[model samples]
Target: MQRKKIAVIGIGSFGKLFVQYLFEDGHEVIAIDKDPVIIDSIKDSVTIAVALDATDEHALISQGIADVDYAVIALADDFETSIICAESLKKCGVKNIYARYQTPLQMKVLELLGIKDLFNPEERAARSMAETFSFSGMRSSFLLSDDYSVVEVTVPKRYINKTIAEADLRHKYNINVITIKRPITNKESKRASDSKGEKILGIPHGNTLLREDDVVVLFGSQSDITRFLES
Candidate 1:
C-alpha cells in the first residue's frame, strides 16, 4: 500500500489513537493540538507535533499542514473549531478530509463544507457495546439504514451439509449471505490425512453446502435478522 502523509488536528483520546495507528502503520503523520501537554506527549511518535490552534488557517499553513494528503478533524467537544479546521483544509486543496461531530447540526455544517465522512465516536462506541451485550452469538453487526442491519452468524449444526438452493435462506429467512470465510490449509503437506482433513464450513453458492462451525455474514432487515435469530 502506498503510504500517504496524514494530519490529525486534535490530540484528544480518539485523535491520539488514530495518529498512533497511522504512525505505526508506516504513514507519515502530523499531530496538531492546542494543548502543549498533548503535543508533548506524542511528539516522539509522530513525524511532526505542532502545538497551535488548528482553527487558525494561517497557523495551520505555517505548520506545513497544507501539504498533507489527508486531514482528520477529531475535536469532538468544539464544533466550531472542527468546522474551521475542515473548511481551511478544504480551501487549501486537501482532497481527503474526515471529521468527528457531536450532533446533527455539526454534521450539517460539515456537510455544507463538502466534508462527506463524519463520525460520532460516542454513538459508535455505545452501539458497539449494546450489540455485544444483547447478542451473544453474533460476531459483528452494522446498521446500514433505519430499517436494515447486517450481521454475521455462525451456521448451526442442523444446517450442515445443505446446499444454498436447498437451504433457501432468502426465501425462508429473508436474508442474503454476502460472503463465507473458509480456512485454507497448506497443499504441499505429505500427509494424505491432512489434505482430506480440510472441511467445508459454509458454502455460499447456489449449489454450496452449509456445515457446522461455519460463519455466515448476511445482510437483511433488523426485523428479519431478529426473526431468523429467534428461530
Candidate 2:
C-alpha cells in the first residue's frame, strides 16, 4: 500500500479509530484534537498528535495540513466545528477531504460547501452488517454508489479449483473480480508472515486457480454481485 500523509481533525471515538487504522497501514497520520488528554493517549501511536482547535486555519497550516495528501473531518456530532474545520482545510489547500456527518442537515451543509465525500460511518456499518447477515458468503460489502458496490465474498464450493478464465464471471454474472485474497500456507521459514501470524497471497491473474477459503474482491452492481454470490 502507498503511504499517505493524512490529517485527521477532532480525535473523538470515531476519529481515533480512523487515525489508528491509517497509522497501522503505514501512513503518516497527524491526529488533532481539542483535549490534551486525548492527544496524549494517541500521540505515541501516530506520527503527530496535537491538541489544537481544528477551526484555526493558521494552526492547521502550521501542522503542515497543506502538504498532507488527504484530510478527514471527524467531528460528526459537532456540526459547526466540523464545517469550520473543513473550510479551514480547504483554504489551506488540502485536496481530498472526507467528513463524517451525523444528520441530514449537516450532510446538506457539507455538500453545499462542495465537500461531496461525506459519510455516516455508523449508518454504513449497520448497512454492511445487515448485508453480510443476509448473504451467507458475504464477509463485507461497500456500496460505492446507488447502483455499484464492492463486495468481499468467500469463494463458493462450486468455484473451487476453477481458474479465473473458466469461472466466466463477467459474462455469466456481470461481476468483475478485481483481486483474490488467498490464505497462505503456514510453513516455517516463510517470507510473508504477518504480524498476526497470518499471510495473504498476492493478487491473482487469469490463469490463477481459485481455491477454497479464498476471498475474492468483486466490483459490479449490487444485483449482479448478489447473483454471483448466490450462484
Candidate 3:
C-alpha cells in the first residue's frame, strides 16, 4: 500500500487502536485530541500527537490538517464532539473523512454532513460476538488448539500464479498447505463465486499451480501463519 499522511481525531480507546494499526502499516499518523494525558499516552506510537481541540477549525488548520490525505473521527462516545471535528475536517479540505456512529440516526446525520465512510463499533462488536458463539465453516480461522491452527485465506498476491513448490511457504514460513479450492467456470452461473464448483484439491503436490482465485487451507503454528500472510 502507498504510504500517506493521515490524521486521527480523538485519542480515546477506539482512536488509540486505529492510530496504532495505521502506524504499524507504515503510514505517517498524526494523533489529535483535546486531552493532554490522552495525547501523551499515544504520542510514542504515532508520528506526532497533538493536544488540541479538534472542533476548532483554526486550530486544525494551524497544524496543516488540510495537507492530510485522510482523517478519522473516532469520538464514538461523544457524538457532539465528533460532528464538530468532522466539520473542521471538511472546512480544512480533507478528501476522506471516516466517522464513527453509535446509532442509525447518528449515521444519517454524518451522511448529511457529507461523510461517505461511517462505522458502528457496537453493531460490529455484537455481530462478532454472535459469530463467535456459532459454528462457522471458517472457524478454522482461529486457534484449533494452543500450539497449532488451521486457516483458510486466498493465495497471497506474491504467491498467485506460482507453483506450490516455488512459493516455498513451508520452508520459509513453516506453514503447510492442506487443501486448495478454485472456482470452475459455469456458463449458467451469475458469478464465479456462486458456481457451486467448490472442489477440494486434496493432498496438493509440489507441482500444483496456485491460481489467483484459489483459497488454500493451511495448518501451522499460528505465529508462523501470521508471518506468512503478513509477508
Candidate 4:
C-alpha cells in the first residue's frame, strides 16, 4: 500500500489516538493543536506536531495541512472551531476530510459546509455497547438505517450441525450472512512442525455445520434480529 500523509487537528484524546493509529499503520502524520503542551506530548510519535489554531485557515495552510492526503478535526468541546477547521481544510483542497460533532445541529452545520463524514464518538460507542444488552451473544452491531443493521452474533450450540438450507436463515430470521471468517495458518511460520501444528483446530466451510463458538456476521433489520433471537 502507498503510504499516505495525514493531518489531524485538535490533539485531544480522540485526535491523539487517531493520529497514533495512522502513524502505526505506516502513514505520515501531522499533529496540530492549539495547546502547545498537547503537541509536545506527541512530538516523537508523529512526523510533525504543530501548535496552531486549526480555526485559522492561513495558519493551518502554513503548517503544511494542505498537503496531507486526509485531515481529521476532533475538537469535541468547540463545535464552531471544529466546523471552521473542517471548512478551512476543505478550502485548502484536502481530498479526504473527517470531523466530529456532538449534536444534530452541529452535524447539520458541518453538512451544510460540505463535510461528507461527520462522526460522534460518544454516541457511536454508546450505541455499540447497547447492542450487547439488547441481543444475546452479539459482540457488535452497526445501524445502517432506521430499519436495518449489520450485526455479529455467536452461533448458539443449538444451531450446530444445521446447514444453510436447513436453517432457512433468510426466511426465518431475515438475516443474510455476508462472509465467514475461517482461520488460516500463519504464513510467517518457518518450521514444518509449526506449519503442521493444530492451533485451535477447526475448519470453517460454507457447507460445514455451524458450531457453538462460531461467530456469524449478519445483515438485516433490527426487528428481524430481535425476533430471531427471541425464537
lDDT of 3 by residue, 73-181 (tens): 8886889999888888898899999898898899899999999888776666564354334423332364454457677777777888899999888899999999898
What's the ranking of the predictions by TM-score, best on top?
Answer: 2, 4, 1, 3
Structural similarity to truth (TM-score) of each candidate: 0.70, 0.84, 0.62, 0.77
Report the candidate with higher TM-score, 1 versus 4: 4
Off by over 4 Å in 3: 140-231
Regions more than 4 Å wrong, model 2: 143-147, 183-199
Alpha-carbon lDDT of model 4: 0.80
Give lDDT tens digits, candidate 2, residues 85-131.
98888899998999888888888999999998888888877877888
Candidate 4's error at 166, in angstroms? 4.5
lDDT of 4 at 124: 71
Clashing pairs in 4: none
- lDDT by residue for model 1 over 14-130, one digit each (tens)? 989989999999999999999999999999889999999887888888877778888898897888888778878877778889899898888898899899988787876677567
Clashes of each: 0, 0, 0, 0
Measured by lDDT, the strongest candidate is: 2
Identify the leading candidate in terms of TM-score. 2
- The residue pairs in collision within model 1 are none
Q: How accurate is candidate 2 locally (lDDT)?
A: 0.86
Q: Which stretches of candidate 4 lie over 4 Å from their true place?
A: 142-150, 164-205, 219-231
Total clashes for model 1: 0
Tens digit of per-residue lDDT, candidate 4, span 1-231: 799998888888888898898889999999989899999999989999999988888998797777888898888898878877777887888889988889889989988988878788888778868887877888788877557888877776677768666677888888887654433465688975665332232333457566556677778888898787778
Ranking by lDDT: 2, 3, 1, 4
The regions of model 1 sitting more than 4 angstroms off are 142-152, 161-211, 214-231
